[model samples]
Target: MKLKHYIITSLVLAVNLSALAQSGLQKKADNLFNKFAFVNAANVYKELISKNDNADYATRQLADCYAFMRNPDEAVIYYKTVVQQANVPTEYYYKYAQALRGIKDYKESRVWLKRFKDAGGDINDSKFLKDADFINTIFNAKPQYTLKDVKFNSKYSDFAAYEKDGNVYFASSRDEGVLKTHNYGWNNEPFLDIYVKAETDTVVSTKSKIKGDINTVFHEGPLTISKDGKTLYFSRNNFNKQVLGKSNEGITNLKIYKATLIDNKWKNIEEVSFNSDDYSVSHPALSNDDSKLYFTSDMSGGLGGTDIYYVDIKNDGSYGTPQNLGNVINTNKNESFPFINNEGSFFFASDGHPGLGLLDIFGTVSDNNKIVSVINFGIPVNSSKDDFSFFMSEDGLSGYFASNRDGGVGSDDIYAYDRTPQLKIEGTITDAKTNKPIANATVTLLDSNNNQIATLQTDNNGHYEINIDRDTDYYVNTKKEDFLDKIIPVTSKGVEKSVTSINANISINPNTNKVTPITELQPIYFDFNKYDIRRDSTVELDQIVSLMKTTYPNMVIKIESHTDARGTVDYNNELSEERAKATYDYLINKGINPARITSYKGFGEQKLTNQCNGTVPCTEEQHQLNRRTQFIVIRMQ
Candidate 1:
């Protein structure tokens, strides 16, 4: 009897192991599907379905993958199998219609679309099909602009063009000579980095990698610049101390960071306070006043995929709670690369909206806190491929955007678009006494309403230029540290020219001896009593390292870290000391000289911000305020 029981247990164990193996494969397939690795995910689901268990679900996922890949022939096979089965999901019916339409089977696609609507797809959802007005709206659309590929595209993916001053900035995955061992499994391409091209006298030139401390070994950019051009908000893979941060499923999420221009370099980097590792936040777009930030995130509470969300920018440079744009602007599909013009015209790309194919750019106007109008950009501005990251110049005539349509220079390309005649402003900044060109001086352009239209810097030749809409009064403010700010006003109210240059020679009074704190640097915060460097804190620390390497090359500094009043005094002291050393090590890793760090010390609970002392009740937020890392300048040589 004992032998019989042992044999029975072994038999059960073998059966359970086989079941777990099949289940594990399903999870692997699901992860691949989520990441958009369609080809590999389809293979995995195919093998899973061969075992017959959960075959219906596996078939549906496989069909969806093929449909996403635009392989309608293969997708229709599995989609038909699933649709014929009883109790199929309403979405599957709709997806079947889309797959059939991909093969130009309009009549059969209409059949499935009708079934989808009958099974509860809203009339609005079915408008893309069986709606004459909607179909004709796409068919009868007239081209409003001409698009041509820019010179900066690479053989790999290159996209997300944003113009700042005279330079166009974008992200690219070109094989930049750096020998990175790992390639993205999805496309087998190198990670993205921001590239720039100056709008030269006759034409926009080929792009070059942006210098200073911005580019890393990982993905970067698809960024938005502040009107003053001194501040940049960009998307990057979550990282700490040069290591990528991944979620539990081994997927790296994106986060937004803020950095400012100091002296001639982009420094003072800090992650927006609300970024979390559990989800992604990327594709930043700033309001005209820079007081509101719009971005795309797949965090909890979103409609689905990645929804566009906005956060109020406080005066102190911190971000407020994020609010969703709601179902009107978001759908079960992704909505990303949001760009809002000065006229409050909202633009975003979505796959959920009725469109030509994949992701299509959509324009809308908001009034009284509601989406008043939403229309597809249509025709020339869109195609049967992914066309996103639409940005128009202030003139509403010409601009730069990105797309992955066929016949492009690379997997994606920056396209220069011209619609109407636009205005251009050009100038230079110099020292009044020496008459030498001032490179990297920040130039702020303000409209008649005192709205910051753009902020940029003078290049090595002290040259600056930007596109502006005609019929506007404007002022240009060129400023540099140790130099008196120069403001030049101009009236372009009646100028109807396509491109005009305003050649103003800005002169500034130099005051090199004055000592001013590095006010751009913000205090880095840590979680509880943790000392390990976090993704959010690395940006701030990188700023310090960058400042030391560039503007204050010979400056010495000290790290003063503190802890909250929660832990025992001895424990808090050790934790705070660790935090200080962690910050010190981070700077050293970033190539800062050890001799430049005068001291690394911790104050523990001795430096509590509020009365969050021993017996005082305090909220977690208040306690977090006490745990801080401060950078104190020791000397500037």
Candidate 2:
């Protein structure tokens, strides 16, 4: 008996020793890898593996090191060993499949993918299966290289790569970042300029700068060109000898500047005065049509930190007073550098997230003033450091942004990428009766066969846009509680080079041409703060699914639920997300394809046609209508 006890104790000590060794080696590898020493980390991981051939952790680390070093060929071998080792964690299966996909092995990738799904994997992480890089790699037979490094700076020179119409433009710390440097003694860059990179990528304004803009002086950096490359908008600040002024940083105060090309020569360059002396603003982003401007500012009465705001460019060229984008887009954390792609997607950088670092590039899709999918651009675009101020070309196949990670020339140098956003539709809501804009109206965008895609509310001006992809046809339905609902068509033909304004009117008639009339569209309302399928909501979604299933029995519907501006932004967002997902999940279970179903977006307080929350008394019925279920057709084969 004593001999047996000795053997058991001896075995335990061996296991402990092995574990301690593995832990120490892992710590070393992690530290080395974190310090950008990928080769050293790979070596250490290999040493550990050589010591313990059965060490699954060591094997996985080795694979990660190889992948990080852009040696997917080696990573594939290690990852395959781990995957076939069997009984690996489900997450590991995904990693293994991803490695397989990395090596242009989709057929093998599918095998592991099946294991991952069978083992309960998250299918919605589309970056793995749907990212442009992955698509380009698989279909085009190229390598999908993840971001190996990021470097941040006060200025990003890579904006030149994102130039419009063959013009050269970039974000700089030159003499013209802001109108004037205030308390921070920073204003437009006195020396900094959006130095147009010459044919050889030099900061040669002669080739880079527009004739009119070249003379403005002050700092002219961080500039973004219009989608078609016709309009040039940038931040202006007081400047020093050549450095950008702090004023242009959206601090003490900031202003957005604009210029347009008329007869080939740049004309009319000046500052935008919509920013109040009482408030500070910077980082101007113009929408596809050059009609909407999005910026960031610290003008007190906001959601906190810095919030994103927009002002509609009136017909006469004056901008409407800045309107706060609300709590969803403006987290308590600073939201800066607003960017809108040709596809109408909004991208910005923020520290208010679960990212790989300090500030990561986050994005959302807003149409008529409603945001959908406030998500982090993970892995390839984000890292364990700050990566902000992203810009993509007009075609959107290539993107450029600034980051400070491992690979780059210096702090905040430019990085290029191949990217393309899927298609989506956005618009507004109004009263057919008076044609007056309706605020807090719910806009439910459905697809061709009638399925919920996303649900959002209109802004103070009765505007809302539905977020969808190129593969889907859209129907925008407008509804206000206690008011008749109206559904209109919004088609995205891929050639529309501007932000389309789609309007739907909800009306309840007092009298018909001959006598009293009933109504035009049905208003779907909700109970207090609920996302559960109320009989009313069910009736609506059911009507949609009924129409769709009649066309295709094997139809898949995606129901996106929503809520109004009645609670904390984050909490409201969470509730809204739950509401949308619950609606989608319900319909999916009720004969909708779990795969055919696409997404649920919780717009939170971001989309509000009227400032109703915290106000005296917004009708429960109105709030109910504001709370809604939106359907979009995802796939119709």
Candidate 3:
């Protein structure tokens, strides 16, 4: 669960047909895939395709195998093939999009994501596409803080860092005494153990594993230490009492154990009372006052795969019943890695919410148990990979987080950084034609994913301001009745020196009446040989109706339809007449007065606007220009 993977459990169904019909080689591959041995399964699957046997299944499974192993490059090649094949499942489209994004091929990834969305797939529910430009500013902007990889990371999985008592403690799978040779089936690495490094060390030349009964051969320590550093709570598999407890599925569930440091020795290890063999309960975090313990669990009654939960720690030494953190902090997807800073700010990692990728760190503060705003820790604190296990210092200036992003020293690495304030966007809104302030216009702020984040209204002077994250994309949408909507995209490129402010001015055009001979509205279009009104044409028609009814109540309007020189003159004339009648009928349906309509007429190829008449030569653009639905006001009473 800490590895953060979204796997398809239907591999049996995925390869059944091929397994029944294919050679023994494919069956071997299928067996490996079903066991979650993606690294080995991909090789076997590749061999099947190289031998030209059951290439379709091999291609898809090979792609999926690479995807499971987080090899986006290999995954993209095979996914491209599988995604184009007919009857490909919706998940393939989403995987293809993810693979593309993993390789930083964002534009191409968006194409597949759109296809996935159109096919009713979630595509991780990200907003990277909608506010790409706005989000990019955060990437391009100067950073207020900097980060560096921790010096003591090993070639194995090393992460989940915490600092206490002048020592930096972290969980790692590095080879060590008694447990050096042991490896977990999940990742082929040693089980995690807590290692400590002195704060005064310059290059991390020495790391001492915490000596206690706290670590076991199975797994231990991504832990929380109490304020006095006497009590420690850590996560471990349910292998206590030398007995391996298993869930109904025969898999081990994680549990939180409490241990106390006594006379330089950690002893009195006991599992939390609520932990059961039926579900997992781990990732313990203590509040500043030690009155509450927060953790992650998949226990019964949870809203999703896992949720954040808390228990009240009584003064006399007992825990209250666990309470789910509610919908705002928990979603139907996994939420884990709770880390509370000294200032009462809550930080956690979740995949259920919209994020840049697999998991992103989010921060929220609570006042009197009421949740405040949630903030996303933007890049490079986050990446398109699993970023979690966030720990912030007391001053809120520096922190550490674990990530599996590329170029790391191990499967997971801890990064240290100082917090930085980002950028603020300020703007004014006004009428385009009059050059006057437009007050009360709703200005909605949207993130890169097209998710609405905040809404503000322009004041009397048309001024508005909002703080935004760095290296992110956003859209400022200005909307007011009787005025054309204006959307301005703003990006906060991370700056080296802090940016004081960025300004934007928006001028929206007001809807105009048709009393003037020329109007700014676009002409409606229709398909070839089509007489029924197209859906797009109705937009302009609705605007026309609104303008006529509101501004010129008794205006007499004329509908003119035209056509290109594709067919014979008589046939073209007839087609134009049908087009004219369709336009006229639409206005009538909209409750327009019958006597206000002057006439509806068709002027076919005879009144061609370009020399393309009678096959003189014209491009599609010219032909389209000739085929138009135009409106004119004959009289206004």
Candidate 4:
């Protein structure tokens, strides 16, 4: 009996000790997670999950760690398990939805998004709620920018390019000639350091560490410079005077530091006043006039994750209070990397907005220091991975940004891009009546101001094509020998395609001496009892002027005007005669020869198309039909 009792006590003791070990492991994992050391924390969480100890909590934390690290492929796997359990936070639904989008599973992403909404998630803070077909809108949009890889990218993470004085400055985790002794626990890469790529005649020559006391053993870089080249600002880990500062949670947040140029070298480094040990402040950018400094931070009372804030730079060199950019420019997710162009346009990166995927760059339309709306830079500029650190030139045409997308040389790579894409207008010119191709037709392209841009002739197959600019209004004027000339208004505005097809099919009637009513024109209506032409009538009248002035120079036409029956016969006669004279004068003013107009006359309510005479009550539509002007082709040669 004693031996059996001892065996039972030993078995209980072993079980209790195993439980105690698991409890200790859980505490260590939680500490790592709180410190933003997701990589280290993830390993411990996975161990706990494998042993089925605190499986629910361990699984959730593992998924969150992956999400924070931007490893969506791993995040989705664990999130799938966490979301299925009961009493889960609604934020997990949102995180799961974003993770699914990172993998390009938009349909399933939307499902969880709706679930997130149903579970009382405040989706109103984002632009996603405004567009139900947001995914398709992004995927179907035409690419306005083209990206090319740079030569200096390394196998590790490299990004945040800033150009100054013919030298490109950027941050990289590349190991140099020295042995790698320090590695960041978050990414398992060497600590970031600022490097300069020297450019001679616009060609990159050599890259080396920046010359100064700027670089340290900890993280540094993603910098900006002043216009006069006397000052520099950059982000670094919260370390100064050979001591690292940490928050209560034991995380070393980032801070902004400024350096002054002295004897051609950067020195006198000092941290910005707004930085705190409780939160992070990084990714510095300057406004066009250098009157304000913009940055990203996770300080207290922010919208959610990191948000963009700006501080006014006084003339005395002191900073004003940091002000948030507001909800229109922020959301409940991460937003960072604020940049402003010369025209005062604000640009940043955000995962909170409706984007193709994680951390797409967005621009804002602001009025009077308030952001009114946001615009996504759409595909090719954005991808399924994280894209940030947008910097544009003063002209707003060419720029650089960083992305961690596929087919890159590094985990994050810098790409030089231009807003100009190859846009084309192409189609065939065919005969309207016969549906046959009209070879050798001349097509003229004109700008919105009617300035001639280019001229092209159709090929033997009646195919014509011309390159054009995006977001522009154009007029395509096509002419053949015996066919009617067509001035088709074509616009590239809001077009999201590489090629826009517009066929200029010409219609012709060569038979002469037959009265050809101008059926293509809109109804030319004048005001009641007025002899002058209305402004709205000019577009229709211009067609007549164009027909006589360009298409058929030898064609002759006459104008006939009429008035409604409600007016007196004598007064109507006077008004109609004056209206006919006004139309004749308009044609002559538009460069139409006076000889082309054979005659002008007025019917004065004598002819009626409908039976709405004085004896019947007529609606406005019936009365409007009576007030008309007709341009009759008396001769065509």
Candidate 5:
């Protein structure tokens, strides 16, 4: 009986020791996670789960580690396990949905997103829930930038490329001997340090660590320099004056520091006043005028995991209170790395908005300094992996960004990109005499040098569309059997929008002997609220005068003018009348006798060519189509 009691007691003692061992392991893993050492934390959590000790907690931590590392494939594996369990946090459902999106499993992502909302997640903060076609929209968007790999990327993580003067400054985890002792626990890589590629250097080996007292034994980099190169702002671990600051939880946070340039070397390092030891503040950027400083932070009262913030830089060099960028530029997920180009366009990184995958870069549409909407910097600028840290030049034509996508030299590499606006020419082909749609008409596009760029046959509806290069002049030639060829000149210059649409309708004359007299000409357009003839409008109006006075000497025509669906209907009617009279006067002054003119009237917004009848939203191009004058022949001899 005593032997049986002894065996039971020994078994209980064994169980207690095993439980204690697991508790210790959990603490160690949690500590590493708090320090952003996700790789090491994941391994420890995996070991704990292997023993089936504290399995639920270990599994959740393992999922979180992968999620933070931007490894959505692995994250989904473990998140799937934890989310199915009873009493799981509501946030897990949202995280799983995001991971599913990262893998392009959008159907399943929506299902989980709905579940997340049903389980008490805030639907207002969910972008996917608001737009049902968000994924398709992103996939179908025309790429706006051409990306190319830089020659200096290393096998280790390298990113945040900033150009100043003739040098390219960036942050890298590449090994610098002796400083190798400062290896980071996060990815088992050497701590990131500021490095520069001199303008005179032609090879990657010529790049070297920056000369300054800025770098430390801890992580330091991802910096921004002033326009004059006299000041610098950079991110670093919470270490200063040989002292490392830690939060109450013993986690080290990042802080933004300022340095002055003295005799070509960075000196006089000082922390920004807004920094706190409790939360991180990093990724500094300056406005074009240097009147404001932008940064990323998680200090307090933010709407997301991290958010973009800004502070006004007074003329005396003092900073105003830091202000959150608000809901338009932030989300419940992370938003970081704020940059402003010379044109005042705001750019940043976000995983919260709809994107191709993890941490895609986004831009803002600001109206008088207030962000009204956001736009994703679609594929090539974004990939199915982490992409962030976008920086553009003063011209807003070319720039750099960082990505950890496939076919790269390292985990994170800087890529150069040139911005290209999407330009297109589309219209219909019709017979000049009958005004009937002509099907299967051959349309050939030629560049300024008369070289054929593309050729295609119009569809059954007589509609043809083709892409064209930006800021180039092109000629569109339309031809068909028994029809005279028509060549129209189109130029894409001084186009300010990202998408330029040119409508080039072509009317071909029939080659048969029984031909109808030419009566129709290109519509004449007017500037907003103006009735005076423009230089371009004279081209179309002269065609009208020629047809009436010369081509068909007895041609009788009626002029009709219309206005876009804006302002009061009465005002539009009055404006259209003035436009119609302007067209009538121009033809008469150009030697067309008044006897050939039958009538002139304004249609206002009644005869719209498209579906932009005021209630429906329309682009500027669509509105421009309605503000025009057209001439119809009542009788042509």
Candidate 6:
């Protein structure tokens, strides 16, 4: 047929014309997508399809709409169509492969990946793997250290590990070379001491060293080894350069110390006093790849009774502040023996809350870092006594931790059990500004996509902890009423990869308590019959401004006025609107941001507390009940 005579040319042109004509629809589609209205965007794309069947690009856009909305189920279909298009570039094949994987269709996804690669697609797409849509908690990785009762007679507790070359070093209270004696824990001798075992095949041999020269007469345990095995760091109670020293109270205190490993043996033992004194600073765990050290100390400047602390070892080998592990981990109840595994696992013991007894071992895995999965090692692993001081190795398998089980030899005996199935993450929570712990704060745990896992309030000491699973990304957010929320991101880069106490420091300014004292933030009241200004309003506003000036000086104030149901709806609406505007203008004149004022909505008579009909004249007291002015806090500086 001749081009001019045939109607097909016009028909095809008409489709293209319609495709271009859908400009208005395109804007709406973009707007919907911007607002995360992906489902609706897909519907709009569908309309465009009905209008112009030849719109291959629009068809593909529909699928992309679903992908952006994370609706993989629907996105897969559209992506396939996009690939089938004759004009689709090879790069588009890469996008298609990812969409198929997004829907959990690994089989189909692989097929597309092959097609993409065969079509000259870069292999980088494979590098970016999306976290699975679901989680399954399976105890993976072989145990590095099992529960071990090192105590010859009685067991106190043990934690912290030192891996130096071929030797596996750790803290224990079972027996030492010198008398095999230790503080009875209560008052007698403590049996705690640093023990060394030969690591034949990534497993600590039973022939680990006991009663080494480093284990003096008093107590010696909880050690950290440098990468070169040249430096041996540990904590001890009853400090002295020699066997034992004297202190005032029966302070079961601990101080950090280190010695040089000479000729495959520890020598020139020294006490770590960079930030410790006559107090307790035990449970020292060194980072696998970094000089940053982690330990538990009862130092006077800590946030609470017993807390975990960290110090930065600069390139020059100097120490920084003994930063408290913060409220995210430490609590009023003794939180001792913190051990982190490189396989995304954090182990510690707490007698504070939710445990079998004295000190129960717990594991915490952060999902999106907002909700913390707090799981007790369950039964058998935890007894009614102090069962803490746990450690784990890189393989995610058998590790060591001391427990005082019933079958042990004495009051406290060392016992070894399999590490539980769990995941671990470490980070800090501190005031954003001061980089200090937001004491007594609340930390919430969330899963990969920000779903809440669990929440724990930081003790007045400012630290939190919970056991979690290895399945999903865990995010944590630390929040206080008037402070900005903080998030601890849960990346699977290995929890123990970089060893610093998960010291998440959240910056929180002290909540401004304006001299205006209303006691509670409930609905505010205003004087009746007048909209000018009340004395009480000034008092409240003063406090409001006080807080505003300090925390959010530049924030805009949205003043909303309300009235009781004594008048017509229209009248009340107008009156409240005027009152609200008046307040807004006043704040503006006083140097607050007018641009920050996001306009006040007047609910007016709609939300009246009473239903007094016009026929009945309600008392003034009844009418005064609903008169109020409410201010919304937008954002703080």
In order of appearance, the predictions have TM-scores of 0.46, 0.40, 0.47, 0.53, 0.51, 0.39
Model 3 ranges off by over 4 Å: 1-128, 131-142, 176-181, 202-207, 365-368, 420-637
Off by over 4 Å in 2: 1-161, 173-191, 198-207, 214-217, 226-230, 238-252, 262-267, 365-369, 419-637
Worst 10 residues of 1 by lDDT: 4-13
Cand. 1 TM to true fold: 0.46
Displacement of residue 10 (Cα, Å) in model 5 is 63
> Which regions of candidate 5 deviate over 4 angstroms?
1-141, 205-207, 420-637
The candidate scoring highest on lDDT is 5
Off by over 4 Å in 1: 1-142, 201-207, 421-637
**Per-residue lDDT of model 5, residues 446-467, tens digit only:** 7777666546678788887666
Model 5: pairs clashing at backbone N, Cα or C within 3 Å: none
Candidate 2, backbone clash total: 75
lDDT on C-alpha atoms for all candidate structures: 0.71, 0.56, 0.73, 0.72, 0.74, 0.55
Q: Please tell me which model should have the higher lDDT, number 4 or number 5.
A: 5
Q: After best superposition, candidate 3 residue 207: deviation in angstroms?
A: 6.0
lDDT ranking from best candidate downward:
5, 3, 4, 1, 2, 6
Shift of residue 92 alpha carbon in model 2, Å: 9.5
Q: Tens digits of per-residue lDDT for model 6 on 53-166?
A: 325656766765655444567777877888887646454566566677766677887788788789876565534354321110001112212344343323333344434455
In candidate 1, list every pair of residues with a backbone clash: 227-455, 228-455, 229-455
lDDT of 2 at 605: 64
TM for candidate 3 is 0.47
**Ranking of all predicted structures according to TM-score, beginning with the best and ending with the worst:** 4, 5, 3, 1, 2, 6
Measured with C-alpha atoms, the lDDT of residue 347 in candidate 3 is 74
Report the candidate with higher lDDT, 1 versus 3.
3
Between the candidate structures 3 and 6, which one is better when assessed by TM-score? 3
